[model samples]
Target: MMTFAVYLIVFSSVGFGSMNINSHYFNKHMEKLLVSRTFGLAGIRNIEDFWIFAEGPMLDSLFPEPGEMDGNIIVGGPRLRQAKVQNNSCEVHSHLKYLQDSCYGHYTISTEDREAFGPGTTSPWVFSHTGSDYYRGLVATYGGGGYHLELPSNKIDALQAIQALRQNNWLTRGTRAVFVDVVVYSVNVDQLLIAKLLVEFPPTGDALPSWFFEVSRTSLFSKSKDYYIFVCAMISMTFNVYFLLLEACRLVYLKLTYFSRFWNYFDLSVSIGSIISLRFGIKNYLFIASTLDKLPDGVDIPSFEILARNGFNVKVTTSIALSLCWLKIFYFLRVGSSTLAKIRVSVWSCVLNSLGFFMVFVLLVFAFTHLAHHVLGPHLHEYSTLGATTTSLLRALLWDFDLEELQRSRPVFGPMILLVYLSLVLTVLWSIPLAIFARSHTDVMSEISRRCNLWDQWKEMVWGQYSYRQGKVTSEEELRLLLEQEGLTDEDMAAVLSRMGVRRGQHVDSHHLRNALGCLQDAEMLPEVAVRWLTDLKQRVDAAGQKMVALTDKVHMTLEVASGDGS
Candidate 1:
């Protein structure tokens, strides 16, 4: 129990630390860079907007100067790549003077080697005006049209390439879309971040089109792997090993029946998933580092996508394993608590009883979904598709639908259909499952109560037998004090103790007192008629004792007063 508690605490701490680092440091900075009005995708209206965005917030935020000499802040300059289909007929025209004059061909420009293009360069591959290096090769079209440019990390050189593209009217030509991919690696913080912005131009008008931006980040130390992480990992491994061995022993002893219990299955899954998740988490950290190392001069920019996908897998697996681990708490709780056991039983019973009703409910929902789609598909966008209609119907079931919109869509059928659906679902269908659950819960509570009462009765029977066989003893003085507190006079205490053969300073046996009292009652030694008489006698004796004590106190006070007068 202690080990499981420590594991949960450590796991929660690690999860919290990871969330803090990702949300506070990485996500906050990325949001500022991507959502800024001045430089964000939303503000790009003309070709000049691209220049302002690239040179302004993008540079300042993404390509910030290194704080230390050894700081590893590697930046992959944003590349505006336009994908185009390759043409076999363009093979011969590829050597044309102008790339635009020739048929579209696959090629990428290198901004580093300016010497590839000399003065008066007319090669279709080279951008002579910009002095940029051009390499003729196959480029991924990605089902798009236009030329692609790979800009250098140098801000001025990149700007020059952007200017070259602008001067050549590349953006205004047959360009359907331009993709900007940027990668930044902050090794000091072990963070690899990637941002992609897509700019799509309008099909007819010259007006600027909309842009979509996305950012994904993965970190190695987001969970902060300190000494405690190692310690917890070791503890977790030890526990898994111990449980596996214990389960194996149980399986051997109990044979196949051991697997019949649901908790055993839960234990095995949690153990296996935990080990696998831990292994993957470690590999994910190394994979991020390796991917970051290749991003500096790496020709394949899509590697960042692979890194992000792997990081996401690690997170998902870890989450599942952690969730299973936490759920095991319920299994443990039900063992010591009858109420929890009853709750578990009730839930199981409810599920079993409601299975048929659940299927019917699902069928009804789908029927209504189809009806809504057929009726309101043309009039309302919410019911335009089967999936959308289903979602809207479910929302309506939860009282979240726009009643006014529904009424406006089809005045005659809309309100009528909605009324029928709600009436049937809420008034009839919903109540069936509730009634089943309530019945199951009541049955479980009554059954558990009956078992608890039986167990209590058995315990009491055994305790009664044991106490009769071995009677308890109490000191005579203690017994006398107890009787006095119970309003019994001193004479009555002495008589009872003497009748039981217990003298002063001696012990009184409960068996002897019981036997003597039984005998006295049977012989009518202390009669029922004398019970009120004895009670009245005891009350009178107590009153007399109080009066005598008061008189003694008065006598002492009078003596003191007389002494004072004499003096």
Candidate 2:
């Protein structure tokens, strides 16, 4: 018994400690990861015409370490160079603009490719950029993920151009491999950082306030899709704690009855598995693109595409985790906490309030598609466009949206009406506390009454047994103690027993009048009434034994006759 008690204590301690560690670890990892995960791919005017901005993960390695961030605005100047058909081949006339001004970041390409614009003169220098473009992905705006193989043998360029103009504008004309360029500012909002911010630039040519991104600590974790998987794993564990720890586990503790603990173990196993799976996912990605002497060519496509796919998987898992959260809220509504009842009862009210958020997502899609339909004659475009607006819509849901706009577009009834309705609906929340208080009060009162009734019967039994180890108890006190132990209080028990004709000095056979108590061990898989009846029979064996005797009509006469015959 001592060993079992010790084991239970140890189990609880370890479980809680593990939960803390996992939560802290996941939080810190997510915080750092969020900073590194954002990379922006923007169209830069005329320096190879485009730039890619990678914020967090993309820069963890590529981004130069601290102090390396200098006070220079322009990092490097890359311009195209013209070369003849000779194989001295490629060179970018890169001038080191190495002073970091307000902020700093490192910029480098795998190998810069600068080519001569025309065969005659090196005067027209042309610079070109390429990046993790090897793996095949569709320019979806042109159509789903199909790459038109540009081979000299099949020269139908005109038809291809026409086909592209007929679909989504997610791409551009003559796009070669995509190049990723990054600019990382020491974005901390300290003295030096904000001083850099005072540089006056006008979006409306000095007509408006400049838009700036402030480094506020909204969450320690990144809003990146990459972190979604781990977030989901943590959410799953939270659900397990709610259902397994708070509810089912408590039920087992109550009534002191033993049953299966399979659900507890199952939830723990899933938590562990999710942690392992994420680690393995990260490893498989970077290691797959290995460069060796035996290998003839470099890896196909950039690594980010695969990383993006992993992010999508995490999103799916996150959705599952959110669903679990709602499930737990519902579970607690039923059996454990009293507060969740009203909220659970009127979730449709909460859902009604959320229609605005839902509409935000839906309307954006409709607006974008309607514009697309207008331009390309119903979802067509010019210049094999790939990513214009639809992708932006999906991204907006995950990354916050502009709430100010939502505020302006108040529905016809006004936001107040809906707000009031939501509050009114949530009024059901009153039920939870009501139920809990009622249950607790009722249980206490009933226990007191029961113990009081049993008080007298218990004293009689104790008195009968008292002579054997006797102590003075006027029948009343002994009966009171027994009734109290059965959950009846002194006053209530006195009143009830008085009504039952059990007075202070009464002495009667308790066995004849005692109502069988229900067994705590819920054994049978049948109706509770049936099980209670069976338990009563098991306890009254002595009464059953007396029942074997029978009264005969001529029993005494028969005995007299028998006596005479013997004489």
The best candidate by TM-score is 1
Tell me the spans in candidate 1 whose CA falls farther than 4 Å from its real position. 35-74, 80-149, 154-179, 185-190, 197-227, 241-255, 295-300, 375-384, 395-430, 448-567
Query: Per-residue CA lDDT of candidate 2, range 1-567, in tens?
Result: 343233323333322322223333333333343222343122122212122222223233223345654321211111111111212123323452243212211111322123333222322223332232222222211111122211111114322432332333212221222222221223321100000001111111111111111111112233353255344435534544444454455566753343344334444443444334334334433333331121244222223233334434433443443333334334434544433533443443344434654564355455544443333332222211325345433444354333343234433322343334334323433444444455555554464455444443444543454354334433655656655654555565665455445667665344313322221111111233333333554467756665543334367678989999999
Candidate number with greatest lDDT = 1
- What digit string (tens of lDDT, one per residue) describes model 1 on residues 1-567? 887787777665544433335434654456566555566765765556765775566555655555623332436566665432222323444566464453333322211112222223333233223221221221221332224456777667776766665665554333334566666655556555655565544333232333322233454444545545656665666766777787789889999998899988998888787777667656766876776576556545556655555566666777887899899999779876756766777889888668888787888888998899999998886897798898888888888888798888888899888888888877657689779888999987777565445444433542353365444336777667655654656676667566667778886555655554454432214432235434565699999999999999999999999999999
TM-scores for all candidates: the values are 0.56, 0.30
- Give candidates' CA RMSD values in order: 22.0, 19.5
lDDT of each: 0.60, 0.33
Pairs with steric clashes in candidate 1: none
